[model samples]
Target chain A: MGLAVILCLITWFVLVNSRKMAPLPVSPTSAMVLVPPPTLTPLPTPTIYVSPTPTQRPGLPPASGGIQVGGYVQITGTSGAGLRLRSGAGLEFDPKFLGMDSEVFEVKEGPVEANGITWWYLVAPYDESRSGWAASNYLQIVTTQP
Target chain B: MDIRPAEITANRANSIVTIQWNDGHRSAYPFGLLRAACPCASCRGGHENMSAEPDAEVFSTVLPESPATRIRSVEAAGSYAIIIEWEDGHHYGIYNWHYLRALCPCEECRSRFGEAV
Candidate 1:
C-alpha cells in the first residue's frame, strides 16, 4: 500500500512537470485577440490643365461696306406749279417729279445722277395742294439685303 | 447765363443717341442713359402700359462707363427709332423715336430743365 502511494505521488509530479515543459495550447479567444499591422495606401493627386488649341467655327464673313446719306433740299421750278424735288435714298433729287403733269413717284428704274452727285432717283407728280416734300428723312437704303 | 461747350459736349455724349434732327443734325449716342430709359417690355412695362417707370437698381447697374460706347453705325427704322452698332460688336439696342426726338438739347429742355432733365 505504501509503495502504491509513492508511485501515485511520482505520477502527479511527472504530470505537473510535463505540463510546464510542453507548449501551452492557445485559447480560441486569445488567438482572435491578436491585431494585424496597419496597411499603407497611396492617395491620388489632382492635375490642372489649360487648352493650347483655338476652337474654329464656320459662318459667313462680316460686312465690310460703308454707305450713308448726307442731307436733303427741296427743289422748286419757276413754273409756279409748286413742285418739290425729293430723294428716295437721300443721295439724289427727283427731277421728273418737279411738275403737276408727272406720275406717281417711282424710284427711277435704274441708277440716276444729278448735280454731279450719283444716286438712284425717283419721279412722282406734284399735287398742287400738297405744297412741300411729303417726307424728307423717310428715304433710306436697305443695307442688309446683300 | 453762359453756355459751356464742354458741358454741351458731355451731355450730348451722355444722352441724345442718333442725333438726326429735322434741323439737320446727326450724331450717335451712348448706352448708359439710353439703357436706363429703354421703353421695351423688359426695361419699361409692356405694350399695354407704356408709361410705367423702370426699376432703379436695373438702371444703376446697366449704365455703361464713360469714354462711352463708341457707335459703329446707325440705321433708321421708319421715322422713329434707330438701330445702333457699338464698337464692342453689340448691335442689339434699338432706340425709340420719341426718345431720340425728345433729346433735343435746344432752348427747350436745356434752359427749361437741366441737361437731360
Candidate 2:
C-alpha cells in the first residue's frame, strides 16, 4: 500500500511540474513557417480643423426719412461715397461740415428734430482734420463704439 | 523694403483702412470693429497688467501733449505695428501687427461675432 501511495504521489508531482518545464523545441523547418498576428498596428495621422473667414459688418442703418452715404467729396456717384448723409429735406452741403474728401465720419450726439422730423447731425473730420459737425439725413451709425 | 504704390484700382473693393507697405505688400483693414481689440497703450498695457493703471486713462491724457500727432502719415514701425500720428500731434501709441490682423472683417469674423466668433 505504501509503495502504491509513493507511485501515486510521484505521478501527481510530475503532472504539476510538467507544465512548468521548458517548451518543446520545434524542428528548423517548422520554425521557418511564418505566422502573422491577427491584430495590426495602425499609422497615426493628424487632423486639422480649418476655420472660415469672417464678414465685415455693414454700415449703420439709415435713419427714418433719410439715407447715409460715404465717399470722397470729389468722387461722383454713391460708390465713391463712404457713408453719405443724403436728405430729402433739401439740405445743402455747407463748409460748416467738418470733413472733406477721404475722411472717416461718425454720428455723435444727435437725432435732434428739425423742420418736423428727427435729423442726425454727423460729427466727422478729414483724415488729418480735427473733429467737426456736418448735417445729414443719412447717418451711418456704427454698431460698435470707437 | 521696396515701397510701391498701393494696388488700389477701381475694381478693387475699398476697405475702411488700406495699408500699403514699402515692400509693395498691401493689406485691407476694416475700421468698424477690432477682434483683438485696439492696441492703444491703454487697451494693451493696462488690461494685461503690463502697466500700472487698469485702464488707459493715463496714456490718453498724455495724447494732447505728444509731438508725433503733428505728422499726417502713419509710420510703419515693423511687420506688426504702426505709429499713429493723431491730428492733435500725438505719436505715443504703437499698434501691434497681430491686433491689426485680428481685425479682418471677413465672413469668418462676422459669423464669429454673431456666435461668439
Candidate 3:
C-alpha cells in the first residue's frame, strides 16, 4: 500500500509540473526579453582611390614657356569647360582672373620652367581686358607677336 | 620685393584709383573692382574662405553703383595694406600690397597669375 501511495504521489507531481503555465525563473541581470538572432547586412567597400594630382608637393609651380611673346593666341583645351587664367605660372598659382573659353590674348613673356609644365605670359589683346599667365598646353599659337 | 606704390591717387569723380608702383607700373582700378574684390570677412563670404589673392569670379561680376560701391575714403593701413571706407559705412577689406598686386585684372596679370586651382 505504501509503495502504491508513493507512486501515485510522484505521478501527481509530474502532471502538475507539466500543466504549470509560469515561465522559467529569470535573474535580475537577465530580465531583458529574449530577442531573435539578427541578420547581418553587407556594406559597400571601395577598392581603389587615385588622386588626379599629387597632393604632397607643397607650393605652386612657377610660370614657364611661351615663345610667341607679343603674338596672338587662342585659348584652347577648354574641352567645353572654362580655362583658368592664373595670376602666376603653375597649376597652383593663386586667385584666378576668370575661367574663359577660346579667349584670345597677346603673348608677352614666358617659357618659365615650373612643375614640369610649360606656361606663357600673356596680355589682353584689347584695351578693356585682363592679362595673366596660362598653361601653354592649352594654348594654340595663332601668330607671332604682331 | 620693391612692389610698393610710389603714389595712390583716387579720382572721386571718375570713381577710379590710380596706383603707381615704384617699378614704373601703373594700375588703374574702378570703384566696382574694389567692391568686388573686397577682402573683408563679410564680402569674401567669411574669414575661412579668405585668400591672399582675389577670387577669379570678381572679374566677371559687375557691381552696381551704390553706397557700397562708393568710396568714402582711402586710408593707409601701415605699409602693407590700405583700408577703404565705403559710403555704406562698410570699411573692412584691407588690401595688402601682395594682394593688390596679385589682384590686378589686366590680361598680363590674368595670364601670369591665373587663379591657382
Candidate 4:
C-alpha cells in the first residue's frame, strides 16, 4: 500500500512540475515565421446601374421613319379642346367625345373610310375602354413602330 | 355626391382626376389621394378588413411622383369599377362607383361621411 502511494505521489509531482515548466522563449523573427503572410487579393468592381428614362410614347411624329400599326400616336392641332374619337368613322357619329391633348394611343387597326375622310383605329394608351377610331389628320406618331 | 360619373378626365400634368357626375357634381381628386384610397385588400391591409368605403386616413396620404404613384392607365371594369395601372405595372386595385362616390373629398360628401366623405 505504501509503494502504491509512493507511485501516485511521484506521478502527481512529475505532472504538476512538468506543467509548471515554462515554454522555451522563441525570438520574435522565429515566431513571425510561424505566421502566414496575408494575401492582398483585388476586390471585385461594383457594376453601375442606369435607370431607363420613361418614354412619352404614342404621341410625337416619327422624325424620318414612317409610322406603322402598333406604334404610338398623339392628338394634336385640335383648335381648342382635342380630337374626337368615334365609334366609327364620320361626323354622323356622336360628337360628344372626351378629348385630352398630348394623350397617346396604340394604333390597333385602321386605314378605314367614312364620309370622305380617312380614320385610324386606336386603343387609348391610358384607357383601353376608350378604344375607337380617330381621324388620321389629328394623329401624330410618337415612338418607333412596336 | 353619391352618383356615377358622367365623364372622367385626368390631367397628368396637374396630377388631378376630375370626375363629373350625371347630377353635375364635379369631384377633382389629387392622384396621390386616389392612389392611397386604392380599394384593394393589400392597400386596406387584409381582405377581411376590406369594406365598401375608403379609409378616412387615405385622404391625407399623399404619395410622391415615383412609379408607385405615377398613373399609366385608367381602365373601366364594366359599369361599376375602374382599375388604374401604375408605371410599375401594379394594376390590382378596383375602385367601384359606390366606393368612389363615398370617397369624395368635397364639402358635401365630407359632411355626409365625415372628414373624407
Q: How far is B109's C-alpha from truth in model 4 (Å)?
A: 1.0
For each of the candidates, the C-alpha root-mean-square deviation to the true structure, in angstroms, is 25.7, 18.7, 22.1, 20.4
Off by over 4 Å in 2: A1-66, A69-146, B1-15, B20-37, B43-71, B110-117
Global lDDT of each candidate: 0.34, 0.35, 0.64, 0.64
lDDT of 3 by residue, B18-107 (tens): 677767665656566778899999999999999998887775555655677667778777666788888899998999877877766544
Clashing pairs in 1: A105-A123, A105-A124, B80-B97
| lDDT digits (tens) for residues A42-131 of candidate 1 | 322212121221123111222421112221112212222323344343334453343221112223333334444334333321123322
Alpha-carbon shift of residue B91 in model 2 (angstroms) = 2.4
lDDT (10s digit) by residue, model 4, range A54-106: 45522334454345676655554553245678887777877435443334566
Model 3 spans with C-alpha error above 4 angstroms: A1-146, B115-117
Candidate 3 displacement at residue B103 in angstroms: 1.6
Q: Which stretches in model 1 have alpha-carbon errors above 4 Å?
A: A1-146, B1-20, B23-31, B48-62, B66-70, B86-93, B105-107, B110-117
In model 1, state the lDDT of residue A1: 100
Candidate 3 lDDT, A3-107, residue by residue in tens: 999999999999999899688876889757879989866422212111222233211122333246655555545542446677888878884565343345667
TM values, all candidates: 0.26, 0.29, 0.45, 0.44
Worst 10 residues of 3 chain B by lDDT: B108-117
Q: Which residue runs of candidate 4 sit more than 4 Å off their true CA positions?
A: A1-146
Give the alpha carbon lDDT tens digit for every residue of B1-110 in model 1. Answer: 21111111112221223233334433222334444455555445566645433332321233433333344455554433455554556566555544543432222322
